[model samples]
Target: MAGRFDGQVAIVTGGARGLGLAIARRLAAEGAAVVIWDLDLTGFDADKTSFRPASAVKVDVTVPEAVTAAMDDVRSSFGRIDVMVNNAGITGPVAPVEQYRLEDWLRVLALDLTAVFLCCRACIPHMKAQGYGRIVNVASIGGKEPVPGICAYGAAKAGVIGFTKSIARELAGSGVLANCIAPAMVETALLGQMTPRFVEESRNKIPLGRFITAEEVAAAAAFAASPECSFATGFTFDVSGGRATY
Candidate 1:
């Protein structure tokens, strides 16, 4: 039996670990030839070894040349890009706005917001030419309901949600769809940046009483990137454990 993504070529940014890894694994399992883009390749071999259709390339998504070159390499290797998951991000400087370092705020915005813009800019032409594509951006619940002590992270993610929506509108006639997943407090390495007190407070606010799981985030991403997702571009899927009731 053929999988949902059989013969598709998928690119997952920040796929070396965390939620990105889960998204990459899911896409590969569904039969897409998965190309991972990340700065750190540590533990990346595990995915390559476990999934026959998976590979990784070193990329700094914040760098336009790097992102373009990496996408070119992916095109050269796989011939076409059918799916693009913008899953790379960082939670920078978990501190009050008054105490936040300017550099850290800038870094978070670069990775979490600007990188999404760059990835979309680079991949859109290929997708438009191919007449098909799916773009899934990983946003955050904090984006919808800004969290204190992580204002920079929240602002960047909020920008991502808006960016995806705007692009979806622009690409509506191009056969390329763009959507995003806004998830709450997923138990990934990003959590390391938060204090225990912050984590507990976040969990308490969630009606479900817990942080989201990486696999859960991946599942939503997969749906957004699948062909069945037709008719639903520029949408934000909330996996915030009831925290994002809107």
Candidate 2:
């Protein structure tokens, strides 16, 4: 289990902090040279960041051009991209669907959902070229069990699940494998986007009676990105703390 990603390169979007950061740290600990993509660099100081053999890149995952250029830079600097962890996402303001602003809705989808598509589009070619790769997308239990207030977040995540499944089928014949982790509520910075009532309600829904930890989600992510995850593609590994019904 140790050094499962030895001598490999991993790209983790939104990895400056929170769950993405935890996942990046786990990957690096497993010997993958991790490239963390984030809009903010303040928290990514390699010396201060909780990881080794890792670098931080400022790239907007929501932008195709930025993603492509960043990937090129990673390829040029690191030589190859063996693992891709599309962990970038957001939960827009918690509001009723009708009350949600159009602009906010678009923004949520742009980053939470569309960004995954763009990152995957940019990374898939590189992975295909390598003839071997692992893709671990970070989805949410909200995608399956939609909450009432956060329509944008839930819808975007549902799209991610669908996209992951489709791409998994497309790449199954190839060397690259794709899968996603659908986690229940995790205590992370993104929680700021949700209302207090919503958060409390969500916690109550978890059969385990508690929120998931970022490290727990990261552990699942590490496995999805490992070489041993060969048999399952397009699979949704649940980190729902008993919240997931299916």
Candidate 3:
């Protein structure tokens, strides 16, 4: 049987590790050509050899020029980009809005929100030309519900949700589709930064009584990027492990 992404070319930002890495591995395993754009290029060297059509490039998503250059490099190498996953993000210091530092807040916003805009801007034209594309953005459950002590991260992710919907509407007639995924407390390296108390508290809040796995989030991402996703643009898929109810 053929793979779901056979012959497809995909760009996965922040794919060096965590949820992004999981998504990249899935896509590549399914026969898609995968280009991983990440600031940390370590350990990914092995990925190039293991994945048939895979390459890793170091990139800071906040820089528009760098993002554009990476996109161009992927286009030159792969001929065309069939999918783009905006998964680069940062969780700034957890604090109340009043205590949040401006610089930190801006940094989080730049990476979590502005970077998505930059990647989408660079990739939409290519998708439009091909008359087919999939854009899967990694938002957070915090985007929909209020999360204390992480205002900046929540706000940025919320913006991603709104931006994705708008773009999906704009490209409604086009073959491209845009969607967002909101995962709650996934087990990743990033979660290590949270305090033990916070982690335990979060676990308690989840009806499942456990954290979601990165692979679960990757499954949702694959679905969004698959050809079957044609009818669902601007939609938000929740991977909160029952933590979020709507």
Per-residue error for 13 in candidate 2, Å, reads 0.3
Alpha-carbon local distance difference test for all models: 0.90, 0.90, 0.89
Q: Which ten residues in a row have the lowest lDDT in candidate 1?
A: 45-54
Off by over 4 Å in 3: 45-53
Tens digit of per-residue lDDT, candidate 1, span 1-246: 239999899999998888998888889888899988889986666735465435778899999999999888888878899999999999887788999999999999999999999999999999999999999999989899997889899899999999998999999989999999999989888878878898899999999998889889988999999999999999999999999888
Overall local distance difference test of candidate 3: 0.89
lDDT of 1 at 114: 97
Off by over 4 Å in 1: 47-49
Pairs of residues clashing in candidate 2: none
Write down the TM-score for model 1.
0.96
Residue-pair clashes per candidate: 0, 0, 0
User: Considering summed lDDT, which 10 consecutive residues are worst modelled in model 2?
Assistant: 44-53
By TM-score, the better pick of 2 and 3 is: 2
Order of all candidates by TM-score, from best down to worst? 2, 1, 3
lDDT of 2: 0.90
